[model samples]
Target: MGYEGEEIEGYYCLLIAILGNFDASEARFLYEYGPDHPVCQKILKKRPPPVNLAKMSKEEINQCMYRLFEEGYSKRSIADLFSCYPSTVNRRLTIGKKQDAEKKMEERRNQNNAQTDRCPEELCRGKP
Candidate 1:
């Protein structure tokens, strides 16, 4: 049967999902056996892995994740790309949100403190 555009896209998505679940040796085995193999067919038919965030050490990954999040990618999508568990993505996003909130609060506090440190005369003069 000839595949349509959607079908081809779906097949690639399945392949990507399966690839994420496989280690290097398994991937090599699949590559050696070729796509026409029964195992390969079965893997392709199987459901893709759940969305999970990958553990990232590099600042680049962090920046990419932030950008993806800002661009409105679902957590599952990010997890799928990173080959990590969905919970990992959620945890990281949560931590980031908390840190951002804390930073903003600190900035506001500092601004308020600076304003308070200025004398009333300075406030009237708009010099502080």
Candidate 2:
């Protein structure tokens, strides 16, 4: 009964995959694919809509942006989620490319170091 965030993300990915619109494993779907297909309305019922942004600091916002960017979201879309202009998103995203896991963790640590109130001192030392 206690599903984690990664599990929820996997379920979303499975929903996207189940549309059966992606390229087939054997490369046949592309040749036989059409621009239009039937869609099930209920597939997105569990998806949560974007909520109003609370008093998120610059570091907090950047943390979210980095995570989403690493997960392959477009700057414009990430801006929309944050209710800001794409140009702002571009400015905050200082890195030019998707980062590897180790790099991402280092960046997160560096960011969290300045946010001691948000992330406790224990978390800084890697203790739960």
Candidate 3:
């Protein structure tokens, strides 16, 4: 069946999710839009529960947090996904980003140290 009306409702869902002080959970949608809402209907259609973040590795959590942040999920929502405090999300993200930055810097330093692998003769000739 065509879901033109439901498709339009997606925007309302997005607005509610973004503007509401709510977590990215089924309860949030059910509470705001009611259980009959298309969004909630889709959610309820799935019997399986979402994966618990506790079973995931720290790296996985970090990557998930980063991906959600890039896709515009609020920090609070991300924390809710993991059932953690927002401060925990912020702290973990900060540390993860710092490590990524350091890794990039280290890579750059290694590239610089390579110096195009030139010998003294090549350096004197100014070929690189």
Per-candidate Cα RMSD to the true structure, in Å, reads: 11.7, 16.2, 10.1
In model 1, the clashing pairs are 52-79, 52-84, 52-85, 52-86
Tens digits of per-residue lDDT, candidate 1, 7-125, equal 77555556754755654444554655766899876644442434333555544455555556766766876777677788887777766666666778999999999999889998999
Ranked candidates (lDDT, high to low)? 3, 1, 2
TM-score, cand. 1 vs. native: 0.46
Q: Model 3 clash pairs?
A: none
- How accurate locally is residue 46 in candidate 1, as Cα lDDT from 0 to 100? 43
Candidate closer to the true structure by TM-score (higher is better), 1 or 2:
1
What clash pairs does model 2 have? none
| lDDT for 12 (candidate 2) | 51
Writing each residue's lDDT as its tens digit, candidate 2 over 37-109 gives 2233222222224544687776667766776776666786677677789988887776333334557789899
lDDT for model 2: 0.56
User: Candidate 1: deviation at residue 92, Å?
Assistant: 1.6
Local error of candidate 3 at 93, Å?
1.4
TM per candidate comes to 0.46, 0.37, 0.48
Winning model by lDDT: 3
**Could you tally the backbone clashes for each prediction?**
4, 0, 0
Return the lDDT, model 1, position 109: 100
